[model samples]
Target: MNQESQKSVEYSQYYNLECRVADQVKAKQYNGALESLLNFITLVMHRQYPPGELIGSAKLDRLCEKIGLSFYHEFYGNIVHRDEFCSNDDVSVIICTGLFKSGGTSPLIGDIVRAQGRRKSTILATNSLGSMSGDDLAMSRLGEVNANIIICDKGNLVDRLHWLVQQITRLEPSRIILLNHHQDSVIIAAARPFTEKTKVLFYHHADHNLCLGVHLTGAIHVDIHNVGFCNCRDREQVADNFYVPMTINDLGSDFVRRVFLDKRRLTTCSSANPHKFSNFYFYPYHELIIDRLEARNGFHIHIGVMPESALQHMHHKMLERSIDPSRLVYIPWTPSLWKALIDNSVDLFIGSFPIGGARTAIEVMGAGVPMLMHENYLTRFHSSRDIAYPDHFLWQYPHEFTEVISNITFDDLQAHGMRSRDYYLKYHCTEKIGLEDELNRICDGTSTTRPAPLYPHHPDMLDRSLHFSYLEDMAIGHSIQHDRATHVAPVAAPLTPHQSVSLSLTQKTSKVIGLLTARTYRNALSLIPWLTKR
Candidate 1:
């Protein structure tokens, strides 16, 4: 089938499924209903669904209430929006976020907290990675600032949200910061009750896709990059859009950027999580790696943890290219990514493909290693290349990426690497010194205006949106299938034969509901109790 027709078929199928889920929500089937709703939103955010049909926060909030979620029940019923900012509370600040999606060891969240949150504070991690060990740097950073940690990744959405709501009330925090994932709405829902007095600030870390809490009123939308700042304000995401430069942790003043004089051979390395490399079709990464190693003298250091499935896939791709994959050395985890690059004496750093790791790019820039990233979409909003999310290091295709690598001279690497570190200091490091003070000013409510003209950094948002559009029908559909399994297993509904509604073999459903298509016919199946599996 043609691509447009195929996409239409998938959309019709999804809409029919969505109608079934709406019925589940009406029946108050919290377990599967909520999960299905979240999965729909996830599909939309991941670009599997239509962009124009993107679900709104108000609609989702209404869904939460209709699904009989205990948290939203309390949020809508018991909570009042207070206009007064309460500074004299038990905890000065409460920061809530999800650490599950990024799939990296980079301390993006911990870096912000360590840099800004100095008063009595608590770090609440909701829906963490699979029983995260103590090696979590974010938690360790909390220790440096004398902050408390709350791990809340257990139980169903209802139970967890209700539990968190109680915690927020008990803590009586002066301010709340939400670094939640696109699909995780528990943090915002829980913090909604205290929006007036507590004054919520949403830190936009993931801005390239659809996200929850953008419709939050009275909350200050804080953007680390100008790309996010413009997108939110232009789109009217929140009433207040605050510009805040992102900050990284200082690994002492001793680590200096060194010069690279080697030209004949290259030693490249990457530390992005497995997700960025999964099913990347925009470029042939495997062939480039094989060719580089084949024509070079040094090995490619694969730092951080990688799934066995990905490793096997890599090997298979290398075999297809008629090259031995011996030079690709995998290092599972390191105490520090910076120290690892320094230890290996790396020549170049490969930024994560399909999704760039901004923090990893900064680290690479700090270590005097030039970065080459796949320009899937610009996640962060900014005009300058210093924050490391720039066109300078970005590569859009396989051959172009290879050419950039081939054309690299020792002079270019040395000059560019030093410039990278200089910009890192100019844009990121100097700001860290006054990060706490800047955060305090924000808490005091200084930033309350939309200061810039409406113009996105990219020439066309198509550069970013097109990536999701390509995978909408096939890749992201399978992705949602896996997500469904993660939320809950689909089992038979507990309806007895007495409650079952079965149509006679001779009775035509088309007669009952005129002009029903194949997909609409599937939508009708949701009403039959005997056929219901959730």
Candidate 2:
């Protein structure tokens, strides 16, 4: 073959591999997806450089950009880049995400935009085109708020980074908000040089243990829950950290009353990821609740985002406990379908154990469905507790939880459900939280600023052994011993630019290793069925 033809063929292989990874991600086969991505990166690097040559940040960035662009095109088709719209507009806030999915950070952006009166200039920046069904549904929902959505088409990390930096620099956004852990490094790196001119905020949406050693120094940190703020404060001192509780659009009095009064078959639901229940320790709690609910004549449980294998395992566990399997039902998750279920069928929303469901719980409450949560010490974020639902809705022991489920009368459901709705309206309403005011403060330099932590100067600022052990205990099914060390102390100073870059590099390296390990485990699991069939 001619050299040009050979090059074209190799590039096509990489593009095909990226397409497969995007499909896998959409299918929720994340481990397999990561494996494919890592392999693609390795091959591209090898092709570009001689063997044993160290890959630098510039090359790595270029490779990531190439992969991101291929994935975007494969998923989204040939859509024109909306650079002109974003660049010329006077954008007040910029929210960045790797993908625009139905859950997590995307919805939060929608809420913020909705709360800000929809007139404020806001941008929803994403890396990929997003899954047609799910992402489009999410976009439609966010579209209600009328925010400009921009997807990066630049191939390779460097170009994408430059593109993002250019948008920020050109638009001169008052503040920039990053959505999740996945987009942290690239966004932070791109924004670091411009930090003095603009306020950048990283919102911590998950447990801190999952992303230890992240360089959050250059930007301010925004914790969705107070617990998350405390967690960040305890780990690394930043310029400033804000506790902005997540708010949703109120479902209104009519919907609240209707859902409260609807007394038919009792349906309990959860929209959390199914893998959360895959751990041996947490699955039993779900089974126990389902079993107790099944014993009652009118009660049933509906769970979304659960795979068939996990459902089967839970069913088997229920059977072992002499609980009827018929009560437990698995529902596939889609934005519209889940909302329909919430509005019409769901009676009680059950929050996930160990790691509480913040967004899901808020969503259920916003839809006027009362939620029941176990107040466990192991939960990384006490979202249930933070929401301050009535004491009757919070359970500590297994028997107590079962009793609450069994004894809940029609009146009790109505009263509790209304209370939840009221609480959501008062506390979680977008206007109530003053998102606009906060953004204004951030933009004008009136926002509170604490001394940033100098990690090199203060060694204690980097230590998280106790926190790691606590998370380790939760992961392994061991009981967590809550103590004074868990409390958030006043943060020390901030890290220097050099220190920040070093920390970010360290985290990126650690993430690469973590991804490899996870991919290996998934590959091994895939082998189990083959071995069993033999």
Candidate 3:
């Protein structure tokens, strides 16, 4: 068949499968619904590699628009523009974030900025805005705090930089805080003309190795975590940076009480991305620990927000190692993920190696769950060693992890969990951390001596910089290599003829049922004489 005809057939098949899934859901046949859903996903996966591309496509956006799936369209669509830029020169502070995703230190920083009672305008990068919505926790929190939010339009890097420059020039704020190094180059370029007017602050949330390309000389490097700040300060390039630890604003007294009061299971949870496990870096240690845990009764691992493909890879690895997959539970991404973690009675929270879980670690501790993390040189700048309570677990070697896991009893876990919660309250809580004071000091022209470059300058250092693009490429390459190493292909083969036919029949039946139901409703309405008279 021609391309057009093939696409038409594919659309028809997709629509039919969707109808079948809806019917199954309505009839409470969840298993059947799941099977149909999987078949639909398989079809989509075959058509689109990486899965993310499906959501990013214009065709999918158009289809969503035609189908009145506003939420889906908003979420999946590439371009996100929020033209809330206030021309008022009264705005003193401009808090700019590179990515729009709900995670990261941006939301926390935004919350702190708002709490400081300063006239501020927040700008979100276009790429980040695609993943956000009006109801998103970060957006809602910003709204509640009355921070003016501006989402940039999607464009090429140069176009985005020009737009950002235009916005910054227009706003003419006294202080500008760049959330991460992803947009440092743009922000630096934008503020170059207005360097004397606005003091730019670069908040380093990730490790220095991850952001080597970022030119820190132009901006005031502010490390939020103590150890992270120390690590950055020790570096010659970022030595003169300020230290302002993260403050958890949403943690209330009642929340703390609930955390301490709640009874939980011996289940362990990790919100780390499965891609972090793709390489043999930490997987061997993880496998060793998991095997030991599973050998004992009443122990389970609940992984959060792992992709289906990654989960499958992990399951296969477990099986290859003679481990049981039944003990491992995969939790998909959801808005109420914190509630889900608590409700599932996750007692112990685990952190990934090389790159530690910063936000997740704070959250798990705040929820009164003890966390254990493996620290290495790569994670020295962003590890749990500094933020976590002394009682909380941190291991450098595999044997250390095994020993910690083996000796810890239920009572010990509870004690450590409580300590972790207290540690969060004392150090990380917004009420305790004097973020406003530090922000005000910076805004008030409190100048600090600039530090020298830690590492010798290299001609090709910029290209080697572990920016998001570089990291993504590395992750993709690692995934491909890891898959090959395990003898797994990137994409699975097509379904059998029997499976396709069964799915098709389910769809056809569902369409018939839907038609019958619509017809019956129309007939009932036609039978009403009063309705006809009206």
Candidate 4:
């Protein structure tokens, strides 16, 4: 089939699924409908199925809200757990996530625990959390400080979910903060009925995607930055939406970095996991790096896991362009990504493309290295807009990125680095990232009467059909890779895809869109209304 025909098929598939979901709801089969909704989301997200003119977050959020309400209404008293447990007063907040030993929301979860004291917080690690980060990096211990909570990886999807629900029943925490993988229907299903006693907060870390937790009943969707707050708030969804200033808590280590520049060649560095460096950017991220390096006889230090194949591809591409591939050196996963950048005396740093890495960007900026994020969808996507907008490091087009980085000198680095540091201190510093007030308000059932200012979507924001073929090409087939649609998220430093070293080298894992396993497949069965699907 031609490109247009392909897109039409995807659109039709989604439309039929949407209708099926509605039928299920009308018939009051909420769990089956919820399962169907999840399938619809994955098809849209990874496969880029354009169901309409725009793939907006609110589309499925409204459905999720509807299904969640119906399910909670019918099944609140019938909730079950795998095990019965005694209550523990120590559990005040449950930090739930898929199996990510480091990076992603682990640090933020740690910050939440630190705020209330570690003893009052519990980390409920689900089976979907895969890809362990660096063993030595203290951030892997949820960012320099230590926080070991409960582990809930008992059984398959259903069993683990039941296990999670039972933990909540026993502990009865005052609040349950979700730093979950977005497409986790299990987390959504498990936590749906518990909102009466415990407040559920959807911390919008991965605000760009259509995840399961957006508009559930009794849940408050908290956007960490202004752009996210504006985008989601303008769209209609059932949940109570609010904005909170984003923050990160670390060990508060005092360290100073000095950029040791070798007068002739400019050394640039990027620390985002290689997955963030995909074709989704304006130009391929490797091409962007190569152009910047070739312009001034420069060198670049990359401080994350780069698959052997990607490394060879860059080598071949560099040789074809008549630039030495040696100019681009790939360093294995460094314990300290920002420190590696600073220690290498990098004159300039580039943020990960498409999905910008705000967590690491803040760290590098705080360390006083000049950095900029490649921007396309500003207000539409969850980015570091609270800081990178108006005056800071945002390059909108490829030509602009080339022009800026090509002419940058050490003096430029120092000046821009100083300005970037100023932005960091003014906005994201630890003292500034307090959620206590927001927490208290959430607990008290207080909400802002003010609505968010309307921000129009970027012209290039909606893809007619966004092709994500580059993802599977990299051979990232670890477990739970598709659980949150994480291959497309604002990724943490991907030490290795799903923490499997050799798997990153080979390309054998079946795509999440396979025949029997795909949610899209389940979507087809939901069309029957009373199919009683899992």
Candidate 5:
């Protein structure tokens, strides 16, 4: 079919699905309609695969494994055992939440949809959390299900989508997916350079404001019957065109086989950031975990970070609340420190932010340590969630984490270590499929889930943006001063190396290091001569 005609047919099919879903929701036949929609997506739009030349056999295998685990881990809840993913009978679906890098609310809704998988259900890479962060909504959905996985694409632009599309071309697995209109535009932009025959199922997560966009662009719409678009105000007619996919209760044995493989260690991962909202901001949740664990005694928690220097700035109050310094292992792993930190034998890995947590959590999972994430939909999409082991993916809320940790028995921890190795075999072992899927999503515009801001945002709304802008100006000014300072370097470092070395030796040699021998004293005296310039 030609592009325009094809898009029309697809849009019609989607609208039909939407009508059915809306009818179901209205008639209270929610469960039946949702199952039908998932089955339809699996049978129809998802079946197409890229040619072997475009995606090699080896590449395909890698892709399937990547999607298998990527989708499974995000929604199903990370399992600690490798054996947990023994069966692959369930169809995994990725929900294209939205276009923006932040606020993937529809992706959060994917967890609710994924529970329907008989073998394994997954909501993949919908980063636009509807309106506000709504991370709790995603976690709440995940908390209720054991069969699905939420495969979020949150990482480098090239890598994340590449991993996803590579899997699509390779595995040719049954994938029931949705792409929000805004994100679909971005993905379409990326995919335009590639072949146009590539069939991607697009679902508009937000329909109200986007109805004009879709209508104007003459875009094909999928899931228009069942999916609801968030963040679109004042257009109830567009919204009325569809219904959100309803909750599903009975997943199949395949789901049990797919997600319940080997047990994984229980840990959450994050890094420290100065932003009060950053996961590293030392929120009450972290303190609550430590306090609960310490009250029970013998709690060993390992918090991993990128640079070890960051640990020095860790809030003492937060640490004191959790456990003694010894029980909490702070890992600052640069390329230089990874080996040493791993050698320390960490059991469970935990992190908050997706960017810093991605590599660290992957390394820990590869080592057979399970991961605990407080379940932020933002990081899960743009960064961390995809790389995690399928069964090893544990989704937690900040408040309920202590209770989750309390449930992990010592035996479970050991079981998780072994399964973690299995997770490595299945997912994190390669970078191929993960890269492809992410690229595909970007190309397909499934990743671009939100509209750009209409104007310059409020300063508070743009904290990171404003901070970086300020820093950029400071950097430019600093650069100018440094250039000027270079001409006067000789005058600035007036002390000869030999003399300074001798003074250092003198100070080191003296226990008291009296004023005469101290560098501070010498510098003060030296400053007197340059007082006019100072």
Candidate 6:
């Protein structure tokens, strides 16, 4: 090729070079369409099963090498550019940052949009990578068909609604959905109409007693779904759907699945802070378990934290509790995290209640590690514990945990790991969720993802609040009365009527005497000048 042709070939990155060919075909703007099509093809060409076992050895290695090259290879002659593994958009540029779905091959919403089209499923996520990816995955799919989307950022109220509305308008979606954690009252107060059809799913992640404020607010016009504990006696606490794990199919050959049957240690990872609540308060039950674990010698402990700040916080306590700092693994880096899990011989994983049903749990179980987690009766935000039911495979709180460990031998651990892995494969896998089916239904408008239940103002609300107040007051009153009775001395003798009258008179006299003493001191101070003059 001549220098001009070679130069023109490289310039194709910026300007469309196929214009001449399109002009020959008499098709206008075919180059642009072809570029879009090429982009779609490129998205597929580079797609591999995210770093988990779903992608076989060859593709997994290729993915690792590609990702490795991005980080190791220099850009602009010196700066290494790990972010070059795929094409990126500025708005969607967030896909490459933080503890996102970086570790494994979780699909992004953009990928799904390119892969499947539209989906109809409730996307839920915490502020973590797994959950964020889940949310983005949902949003991307929705963006594909221009369906409505809503978002909730539980504790941290980063106001993105304005930008979100702007995005929704750009996409021309059918509706929008939104939810918030503790700031529902503030959310409702600041509500605006971005579009004609918008819905909110209000939820709380912790302590539900504060939900009295939520329930009291008539402004909760949108659906309200509560998760976590409300009371102790609620046997019907957890929701059936909440505990359902996602099911994934091995995109890899069946031969790979058959070959890997070993038990692995896949600890669920998270920031130990438990949202805004401290680990001490949020995961009281987990603290209790840790205490028991420290009493033993053979048992090793691992705490998963991310962000140097979070890791530091986890470090002091785990050390104080005699847990090794080396065991304090930082955030799981997706496919590597998943790979580490399968490669390590972990027996049982433990979880804290302060956290929502974390994707780490899903990933760990996916790796075949049995889990132990707490199950509170209700949450401070949501009305029902059922709304926040954790994925199955967890031996819920108030468990026979020590007895379980004592009873289960190493062989038992191996067996349980297999069972756990199988459970994840059946339930938590993305492919098994029938994401394609759900997306089609959502796009076609065949399914209505049920809205959270709406609550109306009722007189009973006031009555219940009053009753709760009364109970609190009564308890306080009794405690004070009991303390006085136990610690204060009784009257030395029973009083006659005249003696009681005399005692009352004496009390009044004492008050008069105290007032008189105060007056006398004032007068004496004033007379000092007069006495000096005399």
Q: Which parts of model 2 are misplaced by more than 4 Å?
A: 1-89, 115-140, 206-218, 257-265, 280-286, 301-303, 314-326, 334-342, 380-383, 442-534
**Which candidate leads in lDDT?**
4
Looking at candidate 3, the ten consecutive residues that score lowest on lDDT are: 49-58
Candidate 1 lDDT over 1-534, as tens digits, reads: 677766534456356545765777566554455455555555454332323233245455444444544434534454623433344544655455443323422255555556554457777766511234445544332324556777775676656666776666666676677776665655655666556656678776655455666666567668775546665656644546677666565554456446563456677888855444433333334445665665556678888667686578678867776657786889986656777887887878876554455567666666667777554433332112324623346655555566766777787777777776775665556344466676667768785433223232333355346434544433444445756877765342232121122321111111211112223323323332321111
Write the candidate numbers in order of decreasing TM-score. 4, 1, 2, 3, 6, 5
TM-score winner, 4 or 6: 4
Judging by TM-score against the true structure, name the best candidate: 4
Which is superior by TM-score, 1 or 2? 1
User: Which tens-of-lDDT digit does each residue in 1-534 have in candidate 3?
Assistant: 677766534457657766665575455443354344334433443233211112112222222222222321233223332233333334644544333323455556565566556466555453211233444435333324555556664543334445665566567675666663321223433444343345666666634232321233356666666555555545434546676666666445444323322343356666654334322232232454465454443345544444465567557867887677776776645443345557667666667544455666666667767878755433343344556666467665556666666666777776887887887776667777666776666555473422222221122222223222333444466568768898976554444321234332112211212223223323333333332122
lDDT for model 3: 0.48
User: Model 2 — TM-score against the truth?
Assistant: 0.61
In candidate 3, clashing pairs total 7
TM-score of 6: 0.41
Off by over 4 Å in 6: 1-164, 174-277, 282-303, 306-337, 354-356, 377-399, 442-534
lDDT tens string, model 6, 256-300? Answer: 112222333323333232221222121233344444444333333
Candidate 2 vs candidate 6: the TM-score winner is 2
TM-score (all chains, Cα) for each model: 0.71, 0.61, 0.60, 0.72, 0.30, 0.41
Give the lDDT ranking, best first.
Answer: 4, 1, 2, 3, 5, 6
Q: How close is candidate 1 to the true structure, as a TM-score?
A: 0.71
Superposed Cα deviation of residue 298, candidate 3 (Å): 3.3
Residue 127 in model 3: lDDT = 29
The Cα error of candidate 5 at residue 506, in Å, is 42
